[model samples]
Target: MSPTDTDALADDLLAYIDASPTPYHAVRETARRLEQAGYRALDERESWTLKPGERVYVTRGDTSIAAFHLGTAPVDRAGFRLVGSHTDSPNLRLKPNAQVAKNGYQQLGVEIYGGVLLHTWTDRDLSLAGRVVLLEGGKPRGHLVDFRKPLLRVPNLAIHLNRGVNTEGLKLNPQEQMVPVLGLESAGAVDLRAMLVKELSKGGVKAEAADILGYDLCLYDLQPSTRSGAHEEFLHAPRLDNLASCHSSLTALLTGPASREATSGVILFDHEEVGSRSAQGAASPFLRTLLERLTLVLSDGKPDAFHRAMAQSFLVSADMAHAVHPNYASLHEPKHQPQMGAGPVIKSNVNQSYATDGESWAYFAALCREAGVTPQHFVTRTDLGCGSTIGPITAGQLGIRTVDVGNPMLSMHSIREMACASDVAAMVAVLRRLFA
Candidate 1:
């Protein structure tokens, strides 16, 4: 690809992150793109009759999606080439009955979600976004709500109050120091329900305050995803930990036209940051159910087709790789420090933290070469415990040969993260080839 094409891809990525402030929004955007690409959307509540050479997709819990392009051959013969990524990231989530009046201010009570970098959230402009389940015609409906303006802020304690902050580092109490101020304390304190009703009203969605059954909203940094550095070579955005992988997967899934020799799909899951234990998480039966249904359809209900398909399937677990941070080089495994802009990263761990074995890594590396790109590698320092991805969970659950890979990135769980523009192209290239 040309440099111009690379820049366009990076621009699309920044826009994708800006448009998706929450998991619900990310899945919505992905589904929209899939539909525009001629993929039929499937309702999980209904029976599926998918056929070979058909493109289709399905969503569960409105936060997870699986999209597929069935091959020209039967499932037992063709197998599947899959890429997986999660939709959720670390952040602060609003609690039920969230509004609180405290210390001469009206604030929202929030719970820390996932492995949040508490201090990075301090003083950043924050907004609200997530799903609000409301009663519509006596039936529950989930609405995507995003007040994409700076409506909340967690202000840091003044230097005068804590003089040793710089030397001792900023320590935050999630319960005490992380509450975001909504407004001044007055007779009419900020009502969380009223705010949601009004925000919904702007989009012509009418609902009474009492009609709202429940909500799963989170605070996101309001800064737009952008690039920096001398040559505009770096990406700085929120949710890049997994969203970048989501973008790559979606891009690759759309690159095909439903005529490949093998089955190919992308799985965007939710709740990975919080141990992936949720209904829509990788640990759940979401992907397995979809694959089984697909196999059942393509194999004409053969007795052992599902098992045969599983044996021939391959999964590339795409997540962000930890780039070698210049300031903290010692934290990385010296021999396996991946770099931004170098290429796609093949992440592996012997302890099964990342699900990449020698064979799987070699396969992914070969795919990178086939895509006209080199591959980088990542393994945590031997002394430090490794963090896991959906790779192991899905691999173990399905018994599919899985390789974990990603674009190299920095600030893994911070409010905002950074990576290289070129790596976005590199990772997508490899995934596109894998699907091809």
Candidate 2:
């Protein structure tokens, strides 16, 4: 990536991360862009009849999505060139009955979701966004909603109150300190359900408080994603841990030069931060079922077509990798410390935590060489426990060849994270080479 590609892609990524505050919103934003790129949306309830050289996409649970382009040859022969990622990130999710009053202040009770860097969230501008279920004709319908304003706060205690705060960090408890203040009790009761009804009305929907079934709301930082640093070389944004990978892979699938040799696409799953055990997660049969159905349709029900396709298929698991923090250098393996602006990193774990074996990584290494991008590598210290991605999960499920890769980033689970601007576009370049 050149200096030009660096700045422009950062601007584009800032817009993407801003629009996607929740997993549901992330899928919706990606789908909207895919539609503009000429991919036809498919509903799982409907029968699909796709042709060679056609583009199609489908959504499950409104939080996960899979989009692909059929090639000149059937998948049994050419297989599928796939990129997988997750949409969910660590944050504070609202509880079922969230409202509570304490010391004349109204606050929303929240459950700490995933592995959150709890302290980073304090004293930040926070807002809410998620999916709300409404009843219509006695049936449930989900709607995506975002309260774009900074309407919540988790204010930190004063230095005088906690005199040793600088030396001894403030202890946080999810059930107590993590709650965000909504307003003073004198402002009257802040009915969240009633507020949702008014918010839906602004969107021209005839929704009522009585029809509101339930919600999956979470708090997000209201700060916009942007490029930072003295030379504008760094990307400062929220959800960069994985959303950065999501944006790059999706762009490659959309902008990659037309490929007629094989099926090429990207699959994004939700709930990865929470073990990916749900219906819309990587552990579910959603992806396997899609591939099986496509094989049956394209191969005219030929015997063993599905097995043949699996044998030839490969998946690239894209997630953000740990960049060696300058302040905490000893925590990383000295030789394998990845740095920002060093292009994509091929992540591997000897225990199979990352699913990146010799053969799988070699394949992606060749792609990087062909794309003129030099790929970096990430392997945690031997004694340390490494985090896993969706790579091993999907690979084990389908017995497919898979490699784990990502852009180097700092602050893995904080409210705000940082990455290199050049690596963002460099990832897309290598992915394009694979599908080309």
TM-score of each: 0.98, 0.98
Residue pairs with backbone overlap in model 1: none
- Candidate 2: give the clashing pairs: none
- Candidate 2 local Cα displacement, residue 57, angstroms: 0.6
lDDT of 2 by residue, 1-436 (tens): 2323766777888899999999999999999999998999988988988888889999999989999988778889888889999999999999999999999999999999899999999999999999899998889999888889998999998999999989987798878898999999998989999988887787777897989999999899999887888889988899997888889888888887676688887999999999999998999998999999888777646799998988988899999999999999999998899989989999999899999999999999999999888999999999899999999999988999999999999988999998888888899889887788
Question: What's the lDDT for candidate 2?
Answer: 0.90
- Across 1-436, the per-residue lDDT of candidate 1 in tens digits comes to 2322788889888888888999999999998888998888998889987767888999999999999998988888888999999999999999997988887889999999899989999999999999889999999999989998989999999999999999999999899989999888865667789899999988889999999999999999999988899999999999998999999889877865447989899999999999999899999999999998888889756799999999999999999999999999998898999988999888888999999999998998888889899898899999999999999999999999999988998888999999999888787888888888
lDDT of 1 at 175: 91
TM-score of 2: 0.98
Global lDDT of each candidate: 0.90, 0.90
Q: Which stretches of candidate 2 lie over 4 Å from their true place?
A: 1-4
Give the Cα-based TM-score of candidate 1 against the true structure.
0.98
